[model samples]
Target: MMKIEGTLYPWRFRLVLALLALMVAAIAIRIVDLHVFDHDFLQGQGDARSVRHISIHAHRGLITDRNGEPLAVSTPVTTLWGNPKELQGARAQWAALAKALNQDPKVLTERLEQQAGREFTYLARGLTPEEGQAVLDLKIPGVYGLEEFRRFYPAGEVTAHVIGFTDIDDRGREGVELAFDEWLAGVPGRRQVLKDRRGRLIKDVQVVQNAKAGKALALSIDLRLQYLAHRELRNAITEFGAKAGSLVLLDVKTGEILAMVNQPTYNPNNKRNLEPAAMRNRALIDVFEPGSTMKPLSMSAALETGRWKPEDRVEVAPGTLRIGRYTIRDVSRTEGGVLDLTGILIKSSNVGMSKVAFDIGGESIYSMMQRLGIGQDTGLGFPGERVGNLPNHREWHKAETATLSYGYGLSTTAVQLAHAYATLANDGRSVPLVMTRQDNVPEGAQVISEKVAKTIQGMLQQVVEAPGGVFRAKVPGYHVAGKSGTARKTSVGSKGYKEKSYRSLFAGFGPSSNPRIAMAVVIDEPTNGAYYGGLVSAPVFGKVMAGALRLMNVAPDNLPPPEETKAAVAGESSKPGKGDRT
Candidate 1:
């Protein structure tokens, strides 16, 4: 026993034990140093690999009509994304991934190789929920889908010119979509999410910021009236073989735009081949000489001056009037006879209007037109709204004054014309045009005296009801008051007007006994041998007005009996018309 205890093996065993103890003590010290002094660094390093800040998409708002009918809505969609850092090495599974994503394998390989260093990249955009789910079900590592909102239009092309459309990221691009984009596109959110090295989402850590959904917007349009107007206007434009056209309907009392439609319109939902021309909301954007539609304003100014009465005579005798070298003629009727101001309007006599203009003074004429919302922003807040041109009256020559009085030498949009006519219909109360629904309407300014306004409204009724006037503008059971305007189109990039190319326009209100609606129809370059506003535009007014009056439950002013009128109104309201289009 003494010999074994005294061996060198005993000393070697002791030394190995001491070495092992020292190594354990060193490890303990290092661990204490790391846990105390480098805690933040270690935690940060770990979080850097697993924690990621991600964006949470907020859906857009809903756009509805006055009746709570949806015009625009946000639809949930998925966008497939890939993490190139992980997907770059998953070449073997790429074929399956490509198949699930409905992409070519070769293209997938090229995309992955190109974005090898990127942590995130788009694989497919705007995919259906099922399509994205199928891609994800393949268990392809590094591939994920992001939730997104896409703007969709329920009313399609019929409301396209007004509602507009959105971009791929659900951003409003045109029309109402662009006008109220801030209220339509909501704010996105930020959150920290846990992810593994493969870039798969684990769990949401905490929300850094909350997302806000867009607010709902209600437009002033009545869908029923809107559809009827669209049908009638499209039919008119097509029947006349017009280059383009626009129609605007308004509630005269409230200044609410019930319907505003344009031809050459495109589907906002399907914008694959959208044309810029088709996208124009011509009723508000395009301007032209309003033709004889402006005569009422001139007569109003004349009446306000106390210089002209309804029966006041303007000698359109010889059917022509000469001022300097420029001679104006009444082409419609040249019978040399003294007629009242009402008769002058019925004939659309340029000579009579010119004579009235000189008598009333240009300054007086300009005041009423300006008050009627011409050459002004409509306050509708529509994007790309053009304020029409009104030249300074102080600089008006005799010729210019004459033409201005008869709806020339001044530019105006369909919206402007309709607004002006509505003012007259509402007894000279000028209300701001509203595009959104307003439960409490604003106060209107009296632009003209009630007596003068009513007189003009009465005179306009004669234009529709009078023989050889706008005979086609008459409604079956209502006393219509409107004017037909045939304006020569101004030649493009030239001085003179285009021959055989005319803009047919009809602007007025309905149920002359008590005006409820005011509308304007303008057909540009009607080429099917019917260029007269009475023949082309006035018929559209009759059909649409017939439907609109019934839809609004407006009592017929000239119907036979309640029972007979009910059948007529019902049938007429549902009747369809054809269009003459480009």
Candidate 2:
């Protein structure tokens, strides 16, 4: 019986040993297949969980004035983002995360819940490097930080209208920014990185694509002139208690925009409560009836027809002319009766201008305005620029034509008016207005002959020199030539004009004999007692031009008399210069 039991135990041991060998062999084969045959597939799945391809933001271009003064720039910043799924059940760090982000715990929780299905969501944007580092140091799972850029304007509201602003995503929205977005925006690249379970970047694997920086943009603006214009325009707005204003200064020879500014401007850096009105580049986008400012153009047209002369008389007797039901009169009822073309301009008579425009005929006047860049774009490459309305010759009734001549029926922008004045300064050669610096200024279209332009310019000079001219536009030792306009504001959503609400405007240039700069200033809704262009807008032009001429070292064109010079040197009282009105 013992021998039989021993034999059975040996058989059982052999069967168990065979089973153990088979199990070992099967386990070894499985390990080999996973490590060698399916290695790529398993590694891919692991990488899919731990690795990511992230955007490597390209640095936006630098915007600078002609003198290399920085305007719009891109500064380094960090953006914190996270994957809600990775952050799921990360309740322990939620409070700390909320604290670091300056967010309420409940809000953070709700946001996470809302974004639960999203792979990426921004927790904070445009954070300082130190702040982002502190958040990353919290070691919260699913939290991450990416290096990015934020647009910054060093000049702030001073250059708001010209330089414009970008969105949080670093995209241009208006002004030069929107006009040259493609040129100013850079192309982004990509990078592969290893991230931990908490979504923290563990290692930078490789650059998927090299990022290229946007090309730097150099504008034609002179920072010195821009600052001067801004200060003067702001002062004018404040002094006049105006609702808003716009000013533009151009280089006569180059047709380059030397300075442009808008009032009620917003700071691009902090635009959480920005208004649409404040963001508009008024000089280029907003159009207003140029009022008496358009008188010079009318005079130019009449002169071009060979039917009118500087000495030609227009009997504005009673200082008013009836065109149908509308009566055109001078501000002073009897101030401009029986005046020549020169006198008409000097006195800024609506009656005289209406008659003159009527005599010239609407077709001729429209053609002249078109040639001078009125009712047309200045080609400054500005966004949302409106081509001013010019009624077709066939469409003009006698009254409509008269009103258009005096700048009531038609409209023009500050830039367009400036460009037209610049054309006069350029001896009637209509040049293209440009915002960016150009290597060579193109040949301008000949609108009026040099003789006509010179004659008109001289006549305009009398507008500042004559007794009834714009005396407030005077600049010491400079023969300034300009026109002032005080037009009733057209009521919005209605056809009639607003009573007592005026749009004051001034368009002119300095050194009347040898013009170097052409400028236009417009003040909207001056609530102060003085609302005339000569009283409100011309002073801004004077102040800005005085500084601009001195800064540019423009030679004094109108030297004072010996007595006056001596008196000025001695700080003594002296009589005004010739053509100066008391």
| C-alpha lDDT (0 to 100) for residue 504 of candidate 2 | 92
After TM-score superposition, the amount by which residue 276's alpha carbon in candidate 1 deviates from its true location, in angstroms, is: 1.5
Colliding residue pairs in candidate 1: 235-578, 235-579, 237-580, 238-579, 238-580, 238-581, 239-579, 239-580
Local distance difference test, each candidate: 0.90, 0.88
lDDT of 2 by residue, 1-582 (tens): 356754768988788889999999999998898799978878889999998888889988899999899999899998999989888868789999999999999999999998988878999999989999999999887888889999889999899889888888988888788889999889999899998865667899999998889999999999989989988888888988999999999998889999999998999888989898998888888888888898899889899889988998888888767766777778755443588899888888888888888777877778888888888867666788888787775666778778778787788899999999999988999888888887897797887999899999999899998887788899998999999999899889998989899999999998887899999999999998999999899888888888999998999988878998787866644445744676
Q: Which residue pairs in candidate 2 have backbone atoms (N, alpha carbon, C) closer than 3 angstroms, thus clashing? A: 141-198, 142-198
Q: For candidate 2, what is the TM-score? A: 0.88
Give residue 374's lDDT in candidate 1 (0 to 100): 84
Encode model 1's per-residue lDDT on 1-582: one tens digit a residue.
456653748888788889999999999988887899878888999999999998989988899999999999888889998899988677899999888877898998998998899988999988888888888888777888888988888889899999998889788889898999998889999999999887789998999998899999999999888889889888887887899999999999889999999998999878889788999999999999999999999999999999789998878778878888878888776465777899988999898888989987788888889999888889988988999898875576898889889998899999999999999999999999998998986789998999999999999999998877898889988998988899998999999898798999999998999999999999999999989898999999999999999999999888687798799888887766623354
Candidate 2, superposed: residue stretches over 4 Å from native: 1-51, 195-202, 333-336, 561-564, 567-582
- lDDT winner: 1
Looking at candidate 1, what is the lDDT of residue 398?
90
TM-scores of all models?
Answer: 0.88, 0.88
